[model samples]
Target: MSSNPDNGPAVSRREFDELFEAVRTWGRWPAPGRGAWNRVTADHVRAAASLVRTGTVVPIGRPWDTRPGPDNTRPALHHMSDLGDVEPPEPSAYKDFLGADYHGKSVTHLDALSHLAYRGLLYDGRDARGSVGAGGARFGSVQELGPLVTRGVLLDLPAVLGVDWLEPGRAVHAADVTAAERALGVTLGDGDAVLLRSGRFRRRRELGPWDCGAASAGWHVDAVPLLGERGVCLLGADGDSDVRPSPVEGVHSPVHTLAITAMGVPLLDNLDLEALSAACAGAGRYAFLLVATPLNVPGGTGSPVNPVAVM
Candidate 1:
């Protein structure tokens, strides 16, 4: 293993592979496509709903970014299809078109089980090349996962540590997760969605956009087992879940590989958790009802989303 001053001790490929095997959930769920989401039952939704007190709904997605930046290399596309200039019509109409390559830092999106692969294998040991093709994913498509409504536990690291935001490349270790849970008065539970808030946007607003792909605060590989043990159905973050300048060598995104490819847990990436953080702080609670409905694209690997949290 190597080490970085910002991200701490690095994990070698051997260590990452072992960690992947430790969290692998192959053949564990009856529905391989749904994966960990199957752990959420009707009771879980009802219980999550019960947590809504003030009925304050917070959207956790960032505004659709159309401008190119260091973080957003492939910006989303938006243009007017109709400007109400059609002739001979009784009524004029305006329309627009939208398109995105959302599997990057700019867009807030959900990652289905097909989004990542480790050693040419997807979750449940599906061969990536065979399962996913030019048409899209066959085995773990986003359509299979559908809508997700569950209890969301916000691990507000900035609040717990008395910082505005964790510095870029800072690794959120397993101990940090437990400490935040204790400080926030929330505990991880079965079928819950864990949202880690590093206050990335706050820093971006105060400073400026940086290449999050190059450096960002996020989960270290050491944290995956704790989440796996807690049976978290989903995972998300202000930044993509894996700490940039990845602690794991030979893996650009080890957390994505471990959580989505090995553990069969889907992920929400590039969320705007500032509002949700304040809402939780005001409510004196860190747990709330989270509702995320992905676009039902039959063979899509994932979809852009604006997931909501109700408290």
Candidate 2:
């Protein structure tokens, strides 16, 4: 419950708590760390593989951001270590190194369950302060999620509305999600990966970069329960999935807290889904085989990833 103002989506603490109780998956899974990813089995992967009709592959990863701006506070580092000009080598080799604080607007990344905490507790009721520290997370680490292979449903909101992109700060409600599903000719189901595309990158390319942290079109807390009911294993978006000026007062990222802490679902953020949207539209289908393999960093909260969709 935010005490800031009643101007936006006002959610009392009681309501948020009740929602948390209703969706919490603590003690439900056989293993402790895998969370909702456990829903996607071998059968799901095999079924997902059947989606590759044209063998069209679309990459949803944003370009490595090396330029600093209001949105990219910590630009990714990339430099050539060897340029094939040294040591009198007949067969000269070229090498490069790259690095970044990837958990921001500039990078396409996956957020593990450890990334969000509510009321001092991480997903599965683990003590946040006790489990997560300088070394990294002891529970809900990205390594535990491994590779995700499932049917992906694209909710292209802008396309559904016949708009270039949704305006920043526009809150996407459950109704909007359902409408997009109907319009896109897709239905989300168990273990499916639902990607909401707001055309953030397209808008940025056209209008130039703005402060995404201050304003972005994303999910409202009200949308989480709908997704939970659909049993979607993974959620992603062009934005970080929380509507700016968060409908919930006091909570900076209520959707993050709700989806990760309450629903035990991982998230993919800052994706560039423009190409995928076009590919799906041209194919007359919005569903595809989505594959994402995160870096296996033990005790890590999340990982920078380049997710791919095959249609």
Candidate 3:
């Protein structure tokens, strides 16, 4: 195993495969397409609703970026489709168009079960090639998992550690998760959505943008088993939820492989958590009601999302 100063030792392929088998939740639910989202029952929604005390809502999606940057190679598309200058019979309409290749590092998006494959297999052992076609995914498309409402626990690492932001390439391990839980006065529960805040955007805003795909502060492989054991249905972060250069030697995105392909958990990527961090600190609570409604796009691997946290 290789070791880095910031992220500790890299996990071997054999070790990662073993961990994958340990956390694999294939066939655990009746609906194979919905995956871990099946754990969020109606009761869970009601419990999440109960956490909305002040009704302060914070949107977690970043602005639709149209400019090219080191991090955003494929910038989102936004243009005036209809302007008032158009030939108007009575009243002119002003409209705009929005499009994105959202599966990258820039857009805030939800990754469905079909988004990733491990060794040519998707969640629940669905063969990647056989399940996903040129058009879109057939087995575990975004349509299968509809609107998601659940209790969200924010593990604000910077706030807990008394820092502005954890520098890029730092690894958040399993022990750090427990420490953050204790520090934030919250506990992980079944069907809960966990959002890890490494203060990524804050760092970018203060220090300028960097290529997060090359290096970022996020979960180490050691944290997956704890989340799996806690029965977490959703996982998200300011980054794409994997520390880089990856802790797994051969794998580029080990957390994604373990969480989505193995544990069948959906991931929220590139969330703007600065506002939520302040709001949670102000409210003196880390737990809140989370409502993430992805676009109902049939056969889509994932959807660009603007999730809201209501406190």
Q: Itemize residue pairs with steric clashes in candidate 2.
A: 2-249, 2-250
Q: Count the backbone clashes (under 3 Å) in each candidate.
A: 0, 2, 0
Per-residue accuracy of model 1 over 190-243 as CA lDDT, tens digit each? 999999999999999999999999999999989999999999999999999999
TM-score for each predicted model, relative to the true structure: 0.98, 0.95, 0.99
lDDT of 2 at 279: 96
lDDT of 2 at 31: 67
lDDT string for model 3 (198-261, tens) is: 9999999999999999999999999999999999999999999999889897899999999999
The worst-scoring run of ten residues by lDDT in candidate 2 lies at 1-10
**Per-residue lDDT for 174 in model 1?**
92
* Backbone clash total, candidate 1: 0
Instruction: Give the TM-score (vs. native) of candidate 1.
Output: 0.98
Give the poorly placed runs of model 2, Cα more than 4 Å off.
Answer: 1-8
CA shift of 228, model 3, Å? 0.4
The RMSD (Cα, Å) of candidate 1 is: 0.8
Models ranked on lDDT: 3, 1, 2
Q: By lDDT, is 1 or 2 better?
A: 1
